[model samples]
Target: MALGSKKLRVYVWFTLPALLLYIGFFFYPALMGLNYSLTNWDGMARTYRYIGLSNYAAIFKDERFLHALGFTFKYTLIVVVAKLAIALGLALLLTSRMRFRSFFRSIYFFPAVLSLITIGLIFNEIFFTILPVIGEALGIEPLSRNILGNKDTALYGILIANIWHGVAVPMVIFMAGLSSVPKDLHEAATIDGAGKRQRFFSITLPFLIPMLNVNLVLLIKGGLTVFDSIVAMTDGGPGTSTESIGFLIYRHGMLENKFGYATAESIFVFAMIAIISYVQMKWLNKQEVGQQ
Candidate 1:
């Protein structure tokens, strides 16, 4: 008992600092934001009144907010689906018996190491300049124009940039998962006359379920909270068509000084993310169990 107590004391001493920092930085700020969401503070006034739910109520009536919310969901879905598909494809290709596999894996993963803001800026120039010139040369009218300026095509342009930057991490994840798939299983399946597709679906895919869940959850979160890429590329334009909830919060709370209202919107986004994550995790867990 004495030795266990001594070990516990040592562990507490090591953990306490990080635990306190987490509470101070993350937990405390979240609680404070929740409280501020109930008030009418403009972020500058010394005196503020508690407006209790008024800001929350006003969010549903705000057309721009609603538009932003809808656009965010749409953007999230596009990015998540595209990212996963391309990542899985690349992962499968890289894991195959090919020369310079390591080199190609590194090349594919290199973009993930670059800052999203940097990737966004690089792609911004390409979209606005290089692509336009190519489009004109090719006699493609739509490509010749500013894609980021066209409301109909702006989100799709952002989606393209996001997928380019985002696919690397998930590809690396899928590669790791694929590495664990037993060669013996593949050999046995081949001896049994099972084709590649049949073997992949029956054997390799079952082993990749855990990694799939991880990648899905991560991509979903990244899709929903995407702000830096959009900001760097289009700055929520042309005319707020690409504004996500994160950008909305920054615009309202930081730029417009509507701290309370923005906080309410942020809380709404948090709830949305939480609910979606929970549902996805539950569903994915079921799939994992079924595969097992």
Candidate 2:
């Protein structure tokens, strides 16, 4: 079934547009950002000065930026862990031999399909109102101040929103993975005097490793790169306690007109994300291979 030379040529021709599109939209912009990172450009100004490493140095020295970087990392970790655990639980629940399984799946996953900004606002009001109502009815109290407007609680609020919104993705993935596992394995485990927990741990859990790895990588990336939701939810506000690198870059590049410094900041973020994701991906991928 080898393709002829003409067919190969046709395939190459078809791929040309996609390749060009990648170069035009992605690679070119990335290279240009890297180039501008080494200079002091006012984005629109004609004259730009090359100041090697200064932008990078400034990022480290800027206390606010450092704080934001730490917060971003913390946010990524919290959101990923919570999402994984909750998603796995919900997935297991939905995958159990229950009636209206599809209904439950939709109930669990509806939030993940939403635009982040919309979800953020909806939850903001929900937590703001419904929590207070239940609290009053039950002799407790909701958060006194605005959740998203308070520095102490804003990041946590954002973290909760992210988890609530993101749980659906991993839940669906886990459900698919669970369904793909052979029922015979569970049945055999059951016959061997294995408890329900034993059968799950010995059989189903092991088989879900690959899907877990994929979902984890996606979760980590989304947590690290989250921007629109943050902006819509808090604007990294109440004194920048929840400010992330994404918001920092936008504020510098778009708001302050410090394009070069922003570019440098972006490149740093890219490096950090790549390094962390690569390490986690390699580790999880190794585990996946072992399971296989």
- List, residue by residue over 194-244, the lDDT tens digit for candidate 1: 999999898888888888989988988888888998889899998988898
- For model 2, which pairs clash? none
Tens digits of per-residue lDDT, candidate 2, 1-292, equal 3568889899999999999999999999999999899999988899999998999999999998898889988998899889999999999998788999888888888897799999888877876777667767777544444567668788888887888888988988998999889898778878888998898787888788889888878987887778977887888887788788899899999999999999999999989878987887787776653544
**In every candidate, how many clashes are there?**
0, 0
Off by over 4 Å in 1: 289-292
Cα shift from native, residue 88, model 1 (Å): 0.6
| The 10-residue segment with the lowest total lDDT in model 1 | 283-292
TM-score of decoy 1: 0.96
TM-score of each predicted structure versus truth: 0.96, 0.92
